[model samples]
Target: MENKLNDQKISSTIETEVLVVGAGNAGMMAAAAAAEKGAQVMIIEKEDSINLLRLGLAGVGTNAQKRAGMTIDKYELVEYLAAFAQHNVDEGLIYHWANNSAEAVNWVEDNILKPHGAHLRAEPDSLVTSSAYQGFSTENDPTIDDETFVSYGTWFQEKIAALGVNLSFKMALVKIIKEGNVAVAAIVKNISSGELIKINVSKGIILCTGGYSANEELLKKWNPLALKKNVYNDSPRNNGAGIVSALDIGAIKDEEPAECIFDRGLVPVGKKTEEMYVQTATYEDWLWLGSHPLLKVNLRGERFANESVPYQFTVNAASKQPGYLYAMIWDDNFDEYAKQFHTLGCARVGFPGYMANAKKLREDTQRYVDKGLVVQADSIEELAEKLQLPAENLKKTVLRNNELVKMNIDKDFGKEAYRLTPINKKPYYGCILGGRILCTSDGLRVNKKMEVLDANYEPIHNLYAAGNDSGGFFFGSYPDRVPGLAASHAQTFGRLAGQSAAK
Candidate 1:
């Protein structure tokens, strides 16, 4: 521990057994795990307060899963994950996550969540209706108790506070100092004061600084398609400073960087915009893809994909469209259908706060329409004109969709028979949808032990990566349907990395 001050650059040095960057779920969990082992731990977070943008963890065969009668076929789970990543992820790392997720969930459940008056809720019954994975929730189960569901980040913050872990918020990692091939220290900036502090970790520095969704440069270099399609400024805190520092220290990169592609409505890029998305029964409720059976047309007014597929696939297809925009064409039966299916909200079914309130959502969307951010017309052709699309193509697309409805089969896009509702009613409605990136998946390459590896496949001594900051965990695209995969991997590996770094 050393401190040196100057007029322009006041420098200080602090030594700890474990240094965790970014106070998100991974960083917090890692810090707590290290402190539990009696290691002096320090966490530096960029935000004034921690974020819970995406909460929940994905685990298999936990006590909650067992209690809920959810049986996890280990072999099947591995196969499914492989298929999801198209066999591009690190096989050993994926297996490690699959095998240890149960214990990790239970561990946190006992130490962190339970103390905060929260319990892990594994509703395997959710799997019967959706292909999305069923993981554990640390939030209160309204079915069992009255305490509302709080995010695992909330629980982690609580536990870390109780453990007296040293945390400095608004302190951003600026650089990593390497002595020969080994990482020796880190330079962090006091965001408000513009001062720098040098931290020397005798044990290790765990990089849990999250993904690069906010960095346009990384988005362009790694995933250009996402840069064009993403509508919102999500994950603004994760600017890839950690990954850059690791790269500067000779860390390797994943072959295929991934991203969480989400279904987003039209939002102006450079304007102070109100809420542009509406929770309609058509898309927000079921699998966050929108209520099923809506006619999906590209900018040219042509059917593009199987609307019945998972929303991620839909986002992928929609991203290639002109301006990364697509029209979800539907008729007056939307309210009726949404009510029948119980997806009447504007956001994800279980997630009420991510554009949460239905009344507010409707009101905001209507405001956008009044301002011409959304288009509403009495007829399909007029609607197409307002969207600057070909009227005949739009009309033909609708007529063909109606024919499929009559036939009760989607021969073109393989849409299911039940979703073949004709768009024949008057006062047709359409919203221009844009793809959005939840987080970037390209991170420093790490092995099963959560060790950051160099280009030659050797561990960068005393350096580790976890959560969205670690690579080889995903490829191509994010699997949101695999409920809790992000959170589970973060906490599970964060725990493992913490223990490993402490040792």
Candidate 2:
């Protein structure tokens, strides 16, 4: 392991008009778009294969645009995100995405993504969206890669390669080459052969390398109050080197924690969210969606938000909890309900991506009691004692829930209207659903023009950022919907970065 600025043993140098640092959806789109503009493009990916990560992709609102046989204009998508995130993002870069959204998303779906198999876009359960706003449906939308945000990354790479764009894999970026506040190129390492590689860019280096939720040290440094537990469904390649490089070059991070990533999580979460973890009571993430299919909640127990609306908190219900990973208590009937939901698409199935089989789902949840992944008791008082919640509060909560079950409305948690249900069975299940983080919402701060900004909010020239690289772009929180948010930014800001670099 020779670690030095220059290692004479290794030799590799390549130059291109534009060098894209990542091959995720945004990186791919940026590379493809740049290549289309007749720039010589090189895409750098650390993964041995493109799109080999556990990203969760849920394409909702855009399907309507596809159904009408019209590309959803970039502006409309921008409108969706801005309003959804309470206008917390960068307008200029988002507006640029508004222009590129349709073209980029449409192209990825129509051309590259493989469909029809275990990985196809199945219709949402009628129960899930029954109470949702009419605007949420994305009909006739093609099934995507079913990974996380980079679902479209693989397709984008193939198209770029076809156009003769050079793609380098297993390359880890250590830092950027800057001079006079301008980044001219990057210093990289060939992770496999112990080689140092330099990639020079004549146009500019587009860093789609992603955010820093993977780095516990960085997370604690940026936002000390937020938790540092990781329950990733992705690979280690996205360790946030791009952001670190930006920071070393005078990038400032907004104070918000990365959105949708884990504060802590349960091993059974793999049943719903796809990322598994060992059972632990300390694994707590607020407002995360899980794979339990049906969540069991009580007085002290109430569903935090609409389970049906995956990423809906941003669309029609923005005021709710940010992550939504609270606990749900259930009994035998609920189990039957989940079973029935599987038989047909009647109930809101939890893991549209990584659903645990019914038996496994039951077992994973059951082990939590002994392992403390969940609190259990034969009686309500015992359950409350086990949960460490206020006993009176717990009892009253269950009573109130039983009473409310008749009304079929949860005034407290805004549970979607449905048949009244009660959790009154013995051997009750009390599983703590922890939130899982996605990308860091807080990144090296940048201005609205997609320029990487300094601590004083001044632009760093010959330097630009897009995708998850733009921290202040989203409000201090990560929204429920992952795809459309970054997809919009990556395409729009990425394009803007490319065009600005070319200029």
lDDT (10s digit) by residue, model 1, range 1-503 = 12223213546778887899988767877888888888889999987987644445578778777777667677776777778888898878888988888877788778866776667666443322234323223221212242234555656677787787898898999888777777878888999988888888898899999888877788778876776665554577778988988998899878677887666545432221123322232233122324344788887889898775545577788766665667777776654443223221123333322333344345545665676656678998888877777899999999999998798777887765665677777677676666656678778899877889998999999899998889888888766556667777887888888888888
TM-score for predicted model 1 compared with the true structure: 0.86
Cα-based RMSD of candidate 2: 6.9
Q: Ten-residue segment with the worst summed lDDT in candidate 1?
A: 135-144
Error of 1 at 281 (Å): 24
The regions of model 2 sitting more than 4 angstroms off are: 1-12, 52-80, 83-86, 114-135, 138-141, 144-157, 228-235, 252-255, 262-264, 267-326, 335-378, 381-393, 409-416, 445-461, 481-483, 495-503
Instruction: Encode model 2's per-residue lDDT on 108-220: one tens digit a residue.
Output: 45556543222234234322334332232222223444332224444555677887788889888878777677777777888898777877777787777877655656666
Highest TM-score among the candidates is held by which one? 1
Model 1 clashing residue pairs (backbone): 58-484, 279-346, 282-290, 282-291, 283-290, 283-291
TM-score of every prediction relative to native: 0.86, 0.72
The candidate that achieves the highest lDDT relative to the unseen native structure: 1
The lDDT per prediction is 0.70, 0.55
Give candidate 2's TM-score.
0.72
